[model samples]
Target: MEETKDVRLALYETIMNLVDAGIHAIDEEGRTMIYNQKMRDIERMDSREVLHKKLEDVFRFRSSEESTLLKALKTGEESHLVKQTYFNNKGREITSVNHTYPFYYKEKLMGAVEIAEDITKIERLIRRNHEPHTGYTFHHIIGKSKAVSEVIEFAKRAARTSSYVLIIGETGTGKELFAQSIHYESERSRGPFITQNCAALPDNLIESILFGTKKGAFTGAVDRAGLFEQADGGTLLLDEINALNIHLQAKLLRVLQEKKVKRIGGTQEKPVDVRVIATMNETPYEAIANHRLRKDLYYRLGVVTLLIPPLRDRLEDLPLLTRHFIQKYNTLFQMNVRGITPEVLTFFHSYRWPGNIRELEHIIEAAMNVMLDEDMIELRHLPMQYRQSGHYTPAAEKSPLLKDRLFEYEKQCILEALEANGSNISKAAEQLGLSRQSLQYRMKRLGI
Candidate 1:
């Protein structure tokens, strides 16, 4: 009997010590009886200090009646899967999801056991990793417009150095794509590429998130390396740099200038070898006029500025972009969408794409989803907004003078295609599905 009891005790201790969850239990009298190593680490307490102590003695609780373990012991009721935030004896706030259960033996209450899963680190990581779409590089950029070409060429040169790059463009112009391309092409390609939007988090938390945090800095803060440290030896893209308040921008400028960052509450500055790329959706001049961006910080970040033009400004790339999207959706949707009809192409060219490439992509994706059996996208397959736009007229509303209307429509299509293609006759002819000689003759007759 004695040997069996010893074996059971050893097994229980081994099992409790090996489990990752923090386990704490108290006797019916509320005295601590089983406080495992995991629990000690979670609570930041020593076994010697807490063993056999009353639940209200070792831990600081508002009241003994409010203690979870004691409440379970007193009422024999259970509290399962509850999230709690409370300070430990060391004044460190511990956020844990706990299950406090009252165990019974032979219809008598034995005690209460609380199993805690710490989720503090998980919460922090989720906040820091909120940014999506880090996979796009320069190769993902699909436009061959002069504007896009200039930006790409400048970005390629910028990638050769570790200098700070500023990408200025309207929203949906793929600024982050350019940033990632620069990182992948640069010496820091092998290093991590981390991104954080300045406007995503509030000003209070952005500082710690960008720099770092010391253990005793905040109520629940642990010693953590911020985004700068996380992206050390690599590239960090700060999207919407103008969104950051002026004070934070000053601190960011300091880090860029010194190549080092000091944690929010720490005195020592740690050296970081990081290349930063800041992007702004609005022009820096406008941002400065609005007082949303700092002048000094703008100058520091604009050492290499790459401007991405809006899709409306480079209408010539519309046909190319449309074809590329069709091919992309063909593979993704497992359909045989060959191309868009000329009517749809004309409509696309006439429409002012305010939302830029992203909007164009969405329009194409929607068209593909609606077109099931068709190989070509027609006006009806497009969104309602497109079908009702001035660029598209209903077939029923056609004028009685068919020849004149046809000639007028043909001239308009040729003119728009030529404009979109930057007046390149060959490219415009290809886009309009006409031979170069035929396009030239038509242009001569139409006086275009």
Candidate 2:
């Protein structure tokens, strides 16, 4: 038997009949070397079905941000109680509480150990507590801006109260993070934090989901708790509250006023004690002007209002936000990138970032993957459209933001220097009759 087989056998003996869920071990190359029997059962695989398969193959639904195993293998840091989900061969999905730690051999990278605790029961409760506005893991939050700091501080305060709270911002801003954080910090931290996307559900389904249904209440009805009752003694986040239709809005207004709900087929009204946090991606004034929102409901939910600033207004936070996403994908892809070069950083700084923090993250992740061992991502590493520093092309007018056109001129200069010097920056500087210091200065200014 191979060394891994021996290790797996040893691990099995150590964990025989332990009801703490499953355990898995992976090597530096992401190959599984050892796994407990419960893991096999949960994955619906035999003990020896897959002795050396890649982790990516087994856990197909891993989060896009980062994987626990990858981070431990690369950084040797222990992941403390991260959460994840997996599906068995029988197509039964399960939630887990994960812990990852690096395993070493002679101080060198060797393998990693994973312990996952089944949280299906806890997840059900969590789903309820995660009322449409429950708190989020730190990973989902994207900014380190001073303005964001203010939002976090105020949210902590609002969470302590049972009064209604409203969040207003442009689309793509991270309002959900605030909503979730509030619930987590509140008195019901251990309770369910449930959420319902008011706009995503149809009118008939909306009422059913929020107020729930009696057994045989409607078509294919099953006795169920709605978001309000399910989130009893906790919180609920109603996203895009303005998108709620008029009829349903009236029912929602009652819940806000009376703090009670009656299931569709139930006779009696049940009192509820659920905090409501509503979010809108548009300003209240704008929604009012468009007649998309009900002013009375808005005022009731606006007892404590929070405004999330757009990414454009907080450009200083760009570098930190970029670094966060880079670290995330680095672990995800098993890439060991030290850092982004000044050239790449410059390109990001000058750009308008129309999609805000979200767009910046996507761009960085894309550029990193396209270029290998790229210590300094140059203009060439960027999308062709962004390589030209804001210069006017036939397509300039149709571009999305002001920053795109500005980079065009910088791209031209960098290209001219590289070409004249046979792609050598020093030689290019000499050809341009510029001291290398002057050339470097220009590059920094232009973000080339």
Candidate 3:
């Protein structure tokens, strides 16, 4: 019993230490009980300095209620993905998104646990007030389908003028690529080209980041130019513009109309010669109907709208995309992979690529990793998850034949066995009551 308890404790400690997010828990008395390695990294604190110390001693918050853990402990509440900025014991400002929860034993409040994902680096990068650059151009985009060709033509036309352009497409459909292509193609190509994703920063911080902040605007505010000022005489790419709040959208519209911006706490308006290009992962009408976006702002921004087609809608270009990715990986991996098999191509067409072009590239990369001494990518070389997904059914088959069903069942059983045995062929074969060679043969036959 004692040995079992020791093993459990060790397992618990290992799991906590291995997690990506910071884990900080305190007792009801506000003394630290658990502070994992990730938490130490995020706060730049040593275990000796924090463990068994009072929460208030190791960190500084404006008020007790400002501390998510303390607030949860006192109010018995849970908060998720709440953005917080506070000072550590060493006076370093740290920003993070925290999920806090209260724990109880027999209806009595015991303590609180907080999982924090540090975003201090991201905040610092945005505040650096440096001009951003994009290497992608029209030549970088790879597609030959009519849908792709039409969008490219429209984007080039949008590039010729200084009008605002809005790009609409699903995630991973290369919306940003088009934005960059348009920027580089425009006459403002010589000036700065800055890009910001509206969904990345918190609401309270994004306003200051968009419009310049005065030194006395807030506690840590510095006199800095925002993206609009930074992109003067150039292009500003606001990716996922719909993610901005309605109030911010209105401000953006005003900036576009007047070609000027007022700092968050400044009196004077500064003129900016910036061509704005925005992108969204959702349809404009749906976003407006849901009140996530303003219709008037949409009209002002979408002076030249470009809708990029998803990969599934343009499967005719899959062959070109496949060849491009294959060549890319061949150079990166230093392998002489010729191309994918016709069977794999058939499966590609049948699969509904929800992730679009990005997913296809990833699939090809994964297959190449396991392709040993093979010039062509085969079905067995594909990722295990892709093979297991029902999307791998042949495009010609409306209903799976009996042979196909049996093959799928055998492949599933083998996959399960391999997974259970940590992908060890000998161990998996033993579990399946077969010799290793026999199992290998079966796996090859089933295209696992």
Model 1 residue pairs with clashes: 316-420
TM-score of each: 0.62, 0.57, 0.64
**Predicted candidate 3 versus true structure: per-residue lDDT over 1-448, tens digit per residue:** 9999999999999999999889999999999999999999999989999889998888898663389999999999999767788998899999988889998999999999999988798677675535456458998999888888999998998889998898988889999899889888889888887888899888877887788888767644557788899899988889899999899998988898788999987889999999999988877656876998776676567667787888877889899999999999999999999998998988899987879999999999999998889999999999998888676644443433323443555577679889999999999876765568878988897888
Model 3 residue runs over 4 Å out of place are 1-41, 49-119, 122-124, 127-134, 393-448
Q: TM-score ranking from best to worst?
A: 3, 1, 2
**TM-score, cand. 3 vs. native:** 0.64
Angstrom error at residue 294, model 2: 0.6
Across residues 340-443, which tens digit of lDDT does each residue of candidate 1 receive?
88987777767766688889899999988898789999988988877765734433332233234335645776788889999999998777555688789888
Clashes of each: 1, 28, 0
List runs of model 2 lying over 4 Å from the truth: 1-144, 384-448
TM-score of 2: 0.57
- What is the alpha-carbon lDDT for the whole of candidate 2? 0.73
